[model samples]
Target: MASLCLTCVSEGTSLEEQVRRIKDIEAIESDSFVPQAFKSSRDDTKSAVVQVKQESEKGPSQDISLPMSIVYDDSGTLAHPSLFVDKETAEELWLNRLISLRQERLMGSPVT
Candidate 1:
């Protein structure tokens, strides 16, 4: 499982709009994970917490945190939003995926 705290800052878009954009990403499947958006502690920023579960043969489940942030251009034109994740978290997830792939290959199972 992976948890991500995402903060979106945009002068052109509201917090809800940013949340919608985050949900619209093609890489994040509709059924994969649902994000919960709320006001940050600072009162001036918006944040979201996303939790993801990764299935593996090792044990029950592993929890990881992948914090992300998005800062839109200040031109109020809805600049391309970006999701930033820590390099270490990204690398760990990639390695886990690779290991899962190898296990699947060895088990003669089709990789989805």
Candidate 2:
């Protein structure tokens, strides 16, 4: 499992602090087994947010962001969070259908 932490610093902070935070985040991802931390972003509220995505072949291809219920192994509850479905559900469904079609095609072929 991979996780990311986003820390926000005050505007008055020295440049050294900001540089340190960026380096910290980079180091964490580089040292971790799986690099999943997204590029951090801050809104008008100065709140920095980091999102980690599950690695898969199908990359972000969703038209509309969907709400997800993250089921953690620790039995914690995370609800109604907007998430990006890389390749999206549409691509997933299409891939599944294609697999089934290939199977049917093979079945229809006569055995040698």
Candidate 3:
């Protein structure tokens, strides 16, 4: 999943500090998250944000600047969050992994 998709977490050398507070989001939120943590891409963040926004399915993109929910989590109570990746990677994952990982859980089938 990491290789095939644009990961949710930054590719930092270590998330020790962040991991310590993952359970309590308030604690994490209290701290000013360094915005530069996410790795830069060729299209920069505009494309990535747009893709994430589209996958979130709030509405059609007017191409106007969407000022909200760029880092939204549509997973709700699911054990894991939704993914944002390129179309090629998504198709490859669906064909290969199918009902595994997050998809398996959503389908209510225990992973073997």
Candidate 4:
């Protein structure tokens, strides 16, 4: 599902490798001392630590090996969470959920 969105996104990007490419970027609106001197580094380290935790917890991403496809069914919405019609669209749908969970966990709720 998450693996199927790279073709239109980046040329020559095989579906199998789309998700493996991750770019971490952060934009801070403040040029203040706390952001540049302290909080920024703190947040970055925390993010790396969380990523490590995620890797250790999930172990292997073997599920990504499955062949992923997004068939465009002519539905009214064009994509449905329960339906696999649009794989890229479905990925967008699901990643938002993961982001929500991750953010919640970051706020100290702790999610698995």
Report lDDT per candidate. 0.65, 0.56, 0.52, 0.51
Q: Top model by lDDT, which number? A: 1
**Any idea what lDDT model 1 has?**
0.65
lDDT tens digits, residue span 1-112, model 1: 2222255453556766776676566437657767778765553344465677776797877676554555334555554433356788879888999999999999999998
TM-score computed on alpha carbons, candidate 4: 0.25
Candidate 3, residues 1-112: lDDT per residue as tens digits?
0122123255542455455445445545666644456664533334333323233367565443444334444545655434656789889888878646778888888886
The sequence of per-residue lDDT tens digits that candidate 4 reaches over residues 1-109 is 2334544476876543554543111123234324434343322322211122123465753332322333344456755657755789878978999999989988998
Q: Please report the TM-score between candidate 3 and the true structure.
A: 0.16
**Tens digit per residue, CA lDDT, model 2, 25-99:** 777767464756686332223333445555556786434433344333443446433334456786888798888
Candidate number of the best TM-score: 1
Please report how far candidate 4 places residue 38 from its true position, in Å.
73
